[model samples]
Target: MFRHIWIRLKFQNPDKRRPFYEEETRRSIIRKEEEQQWRKKKARRQSETVYDDHEADAGQNDGFTPTEGGPDPLICDVAYYARRVGLDMEEFKVQTEDGFLIDLWHIYDPAEYTPLPPGDRTPLGPSTIPTSPSSPPGPDPETKKKPKYPVLMIHGLLQSAGAYCTNDDASLAFYLCKSGYDVWLGNNRAGFNPQHTLLSYSDPRMWAWNIRQMGVLDLPALAARVLTATGAPKLGLVAHSQGTTQTLVALAKEQRPDLGERISVFCALAPAAYAGPLIGKMYFKFMRLISPAAFRVFFGIHAFIPLMMTMHSLLPGGLYGALGYRVFSFLFGWTDDRWDRGLRDRMFQFSPVYVSAESMRWWLGRECFAKQKCILQTKEEWREEDNQDKVEEEKRSSPDASPAEPESGAGEIDKSESHNHKASTAWYDHRVPPFALWVAGADLLVDGKRLLRRFASGREPHVRVVHQKVIDEYEHLDVIWAVDVVEQVGREVKEVLWATCEGREGWRIPVGCEEVGVWDGKSEGVVGGGKEKEGEGNGSGESEVEEVGRARVRPRSRFGGWFRG
Candidate 1:
């Protein structure tokens, strides 16, 4: 398939063999013509529609209305936005065990200035102290020490650290920093800044990796670096979408339990894994269902969706927002397009950054859907390996087993025991660190609730479910870019961090977390409590399970069972 596309792109199109300037000029002309046609069509639609004063007034107040004099979307990224909002921003580079160099941006609250490094001070506010649930140890009440634990925020696919800072101080990274937490925004390989120590951008080898590399190398390296940089024993992890996927693969399936130990909590916003079949939208389904090779042919090898950047450079500023909204909605599936339209230009500026063709295959390939696993290993392979270990265990435990069997079993068991010890410390098994999962109720791109349920229910006993929620109206992207996200999503995040800081135990929902009026779906009265009303949810874009308790559902099967029966 790629051979065919390459032949057509290179051979059939004579411009491919020509100089770069000529080819680029031709492409720009075509793009400009397309944009002009779109603009004319848009003007025609507006002129055709009969509008009155009341409708006009409503349109002005609607969330999609563009605000004047907004910052240039392209230039105002995470770092730029953080600096603009009176927060202190510092940039650092993290090189993975592999040669990929990841960008890490740290946000600090200007109000809490201290010389004790980044993460050595005590927490601010009377409530933010570091007290163990088992031992009531914390700073004295008179000092009001700043929170020492750092938070590493990882953005989703096709996004940079800019996703968290796009909403200004209302962004999650900024919100955490202001509320007395050291915040670090992490950029994975192939993001806007795809720098590496040894590889050039032109080398396909540089883009030869995917989420697998992120799980095994990038995430751990970044987290360890954050720990070392902050001088803290543990840092909380806040990840969204694909960010959560790699973190889960790293900490759970890959069995790097030490990473879990270093991370105080994992806050997955719109978690992506075990993705349900794309529902309601054929465009989204078609996009996800495309074979990885074909997708590579369409997107090319260097950048996964280079078209966005192309459109940005080719289309005029006034036209890209409309195009960006439509294209993104088609791909990602938005129930309520929550990103402020005012910043639509900026959203396009940094989006659809380069991703390796290999990584694209990982997400959309047969290994993911056929085996019901998203990582490098298939589900059957993982299950078989696990069963082998279990079978060996049964032999060792049986009294009638041979001496030699036990002797060999003893060595294997020791090794297995070490792995099991690491596995025991996983978040799903609830052995050590706590986590909070925020699900976007209407997300059609990935099954956020299923990701939450995998750990929340029908699993081994471990630590508590720190916080579990489904904002009924939000789509895949709204958790990060929504207009009201600061109030609805940001508050819950701060509360969960606060709980971890105060040394609370299992399944503690944040206090005073009433259902926001913005979440007009079924979660009307559920709040910070363990009790949830059980009922089969109707197809009202809401989940059936309660807010807390019950790991009752099994891991989802390959095709069906997106929701528990």
Candidate 2:
């Protein structure tokens, strides 16, 4: 067991988290001997790297387009969550006559609101488009002041922001809406919008959602309908995986402390809130027992929607991509606490049923984070060191780390080696808990130092980028699509949207498609639309893989008759 937990974190007890868990166990044993010498040279160039069979035939019809308006969860079913899950995910069992297996609940169906489609235009609105603003002109010459708040990216849990923005190759919300930033690719409330005004579908409380009601109710009702159509006040919260668990439970439960200062800049791309018992307490004790509200009161009683669409059409797409990386590694591997090596080579650029194992059991917690739709728990002040300062004020006014972290007197952590070394460090020193170490080494989920210490600690006005790095292997949904991470993944999330839209001499950052014939002048890299051309490269940069091990979960599905009787 990791050499008996590295011999008890190398004979524990001399403090400072034993040289930070002995330098994270020697960088997890030099990242597992450099992923076992890059899986023996990618298994000896796995017979001359076949570009994953022509990038699995480019999303087979750009995969499901159908939307014409907005919010359509399930009008009379059929499309049955995009035809029985894009086709090939067996294990069906909707049995509600008291048998059990309704469990299926992944949503997102608003593809119909189309308005601006001319040879093209500019400044933000919807379909997001921009790519050149990394270093532009400035103060007024051309108006660099457009970035107020028009970003909405969100993704997480059995994810689906269209597998990291794939297009022209690797997307991340179409390179941050073509780099201007009024981007809006949010698909929450059920990974692919299952339409809900007041949570309907015969409201069993809208399938009693999870992931903290997708950031407290589908991300503040899609940011209060994108701030009443972009009048803007707050709407710049880019996330990933459980969309940073409802953006850290909607900014540590906000109801308004100026609504997290209107979130002008919060780009946490791999921020995983860690409680960890395999993604925290055995995934909320196996979805509080077999996935919520008593498995929808026995859902389908061995139903048979055309034999579950002919066992998802007789399988065989790499055995349904190895039974979907064994249910994406038995559910977001360790529920994505972090470390995400292009999640099984970016699930062949998605569309293989974009999220919905009941929205990955709603971040495992299930329900009631104040009945979601955001404005999550404000009234701030943390620490509660056995409680002494006696500050229970909270009528809803937090952020700015609530009066320099009140709630506690001795400032929490009263022992047990400072509470299991602040419970397994890694929020870059100040050992995790909020703003997640201002997002390091890329990928996509977040913590960004726990939302930058709940909106810039010390009375606010915070600005930290400190010692950043990204050797590669980006994870947490590959920071929005991972062709490269929109020009080297998060350069301060485009320098904090260019210091919140008004810094560096006019703002620039546009070359589009990697400039000069593309390959990335900086069309924001995270790559996918079938990469592997440039010098026909194949993992030579110290190639790595040996994902420790474990794939299991195949006893069925991939054509095996599930949803059984």
Candidate 3:
């Protein structure tokens, strides 16, 4: 239980991951050690500047370029094709601060991407789309408008869209496209992208970013291409973990409001927002003093890729079986609790989990959790000056309080919302934005109860707050991997989407009513129409019974760690 709660804490924490420890202490110690080392090295180098110059230049430029291929100088990386099906020449690598980029393999086939149970007679993306949504789903009777909004799949930290490229199985894109939705996948800045043909880590510019730039650049760029190809006005957004954090920052970065409007809906898997998990909180708090550069230094010691998981898969037989088993166990814990032996097999079969030290640092600190709340350096919270005295006074009164802190760019600590009394909002978990369809127990990183209340607050009239009351499932990441779980949620989603299909005027109403005809018998026309029959109203914790009760295997995932809250 502690382990499960600890895992959940990692997601719930937004600011520093410090639960009760005097966070930042370790970072300071490490920083001091590094500074001393740098000073000693600098002094020594100055004493022998002439000889050192030659050595420094020779060492820095000694690495080979990736295009050259035989070997990579700056980083140790493995190159491989995706093992899953339904994908193209999709490839990826897992990088570590240690400077190793291990190549990963995947398989791309439709079966791999499609959720099991073969339900959802009507698939989602382009391939599965009907000639006319209002018309029967078959060959187009009329020329196609093709969906303007393709799906935009955002990969998690250190992961690339190629992560979905499964061998023999269609990639997530192909599945969605077959389901009748257009699909577009992309790599965030800190990922593997052939487009990044000319950057080298030895060069300062090759890798330095905050989450701010992701939404401002990465997501929009991909969205633009998909929209151009499909003439889509909007696209569905799907992200996991740190990928989800950057998406939120990108959406909230005040970039293209139109882009936000163009988003069909935002879906997250194993979503993360806070940094409170004991290991994670400490990791973030320690990062303050441990620069991204320093992390690169430490990472140089460990192999950057998750090859163990892959090796175990490709070599799942006899002699090396024990070794593979051990590696598999460790990799499975990367996303959820428990070893999940079955899940380990799947990991070996799929893509390796790549993690970016800097990207993670940016997420834990800059993106969602700030020193205080404001994820973005909202001007509303900055520009004020009287906070120092407030901090001092508060500090004096409550000896345990840490004086206020400023974020990366939010000049001097302002008390606007930073009263010492309130632990920085940065430390607090992100409250779900005003309008979002949160699939609870699916582990979006938001508090289920908080999300339930926020949407249920009776404010946003058009936006309905429908939650899946789970008698059994809803773990983060299950939305993507848990075949049985998706079956449960998919039913609810299809019915909701069916019932809420827009009309001629561009409005979506609950199903059953003429304007809103596809409702799953759960939707009532009026918002929060609880007075309707028990099973008739939508998302009021009903209907999930019908969906979950029908699942086969009843297995959580390929892995088998169950969380009973």
List lDDT for all candidates, in order.
0.58, 0.36, 0.37
lDDT of 3 by residue, 82-160 (tens): 2112133223332222232322222223322322242322212211111223321222235332221245667655445
Candidate 2 on 1-565: residue-level lDDT in tens?
3655776787854323331345334544543553454454455467675445233232235343322211222121222323322211111111121111221211221232223333221212221112223332223334434322356666555445445433222344444443444455555543223333344444444454345445544455455445544455444566754566566554442221233444545566655643223333354455545635554443321211223223334664345544655665565442222222323333432433323334443333234211111112211212221121123222122454444454555545333443343222211222111121224333322333333332322211122322223324444544554334444454335444433432323333331212212121112222222222465322222112222112111111111011010
Model 3 regions lying over 4 Å from their true place = 1-149, 162-175, 275-343, 348-356, 364-473, 493-565
Ranking under lDDT, best-scoring first? 1, 3, 2
Question: Distance (Å) between predicted and true CA of 415, model 2?
Answer: 73
RMSD of each: 15.2, 27.2, 22.3
- Per-residue lDDT, model 1, residue 194, is 73
Model 1 residue 344 CA deviation (Å) reads 3.0
Q: In lDDT terms, which candidate is top?
A: 1
Question: Lowest lDDT 10-mer window, candidate 1?
Answer: 556-565
How many backbone overlaps does candidate 2 show? 105
Clashes of 1: 13
Better of 2 and 3 by TM-score: 3
* Ranking of candidates on TM-score, top first: 1, 3, 2
Candidate 2 regions exceeding 4 Å error are: 2-6, 9-154, 158-180, 183-187, 190-295, 298-332, 335-565
- Candidate 1 residues lying further than 4 Å off, grouped into runs, are 1-76, 110-148, 279-300, 305-307, 310-319, 335-337, 370-432, 502-544, 547-565
